[model samples]
Target: MELTSGWADPEPMAEGGIAGLSPYLQDRLEREAIPKSGKDALPPEQDRLLDQLLSAAFRE
Candidate 1:
């Protein structure tokens, strides 16, 4: 005869998983907006946010 391990039967798995929650917060205020003066250049607020996102994603 053969012996079996103490493991139990398998369980069912879900067909799908949950989604992330960051994209919903893509606010314009957090992005680059044209300056009131109409000058065409990168917005400071976007730069700040980019730095923050990078730091948050790649921090040790």
Candidate 2:
């Protein structure tokens, strides 16, 4: 997916905001709670549906 803007956005981070966190803390915060189980965890059809939805939403 392409983002029109860079990752840095001031609006998302202000006083008492998530943006002010240290890099280590940010990494921790960004980590997914779910453990990966390789291909067994995801079906190929689900990925196809997600791709279709995103494509439709972002299409000109």
Candidate 3:
């Protein structure tokens, strides 16, 4: 996983997930501007996978 402080060039967290909240927030911000190519889009199961990843990543 990649971690960066700047918002300009945020890096990947997992295989496809972004490292920090910046990229995620940025994607959400420009969501409408971005095209739905349907290729990179995640399936519903991916959301659960992400939850598992995050939970594991931040486990105390």
Candidate 4:
């Protein structure tokens, strides 16, 4: 659920936070968790609907 706000920010390591991590750990996390781009997120229609639902559910 890391894409399309399904989870936390897509590229959570953008600040190079993984640099201090072990090579193997960094490699594994990058390979498995990093999303390429927003275009790789959920399809447009579903993403829009999901956003609407989340917004309503979180209404102030």
C-alpha displacement of 14 in model 4, angstroms?
A: 41
Cα lDDT of candidate 1 equals 0.39
lDDT of 3 by residue, 1-60 (tens): 777665677554323323223456446645656432334533336677688779889998
Q: Native-vs-model 2 lDDT?
A: 0.45
Clashes of 1: 0
Error of 4 at 40 (Å): 29
Clashing pairs counted in every model: 0, 0, 1, 0
Residue 33 shift from truth in candidate 4, angstroms: 45
The alpha-carbon lDDT assigned to residue 43 of candidate 3 equals 31
Per-prediction TM-score: 0.26, 0.26, 0.26, 0.26
lDDT of 4 at 44: 32
Clashing pairs in 3: 13-19
Candidate 4 residue lDDT tens string, 1-60:
455644555554432234323456556666888533333334335566579769989997
Off by over 4 Å in 3: 1-44
Q: Is candidate 1 or candidate 2 better by lDDT?
A: 2
Angstrom error at residue 21, model 4: 42
Output the TM-score of candidate 2. 0.26
Better of 3 and 4 by lDDT: 4
Candidate 2 lDDT by residue in tens digits, 1-60: 877886675434111234233445444555753222332332235576579769889998
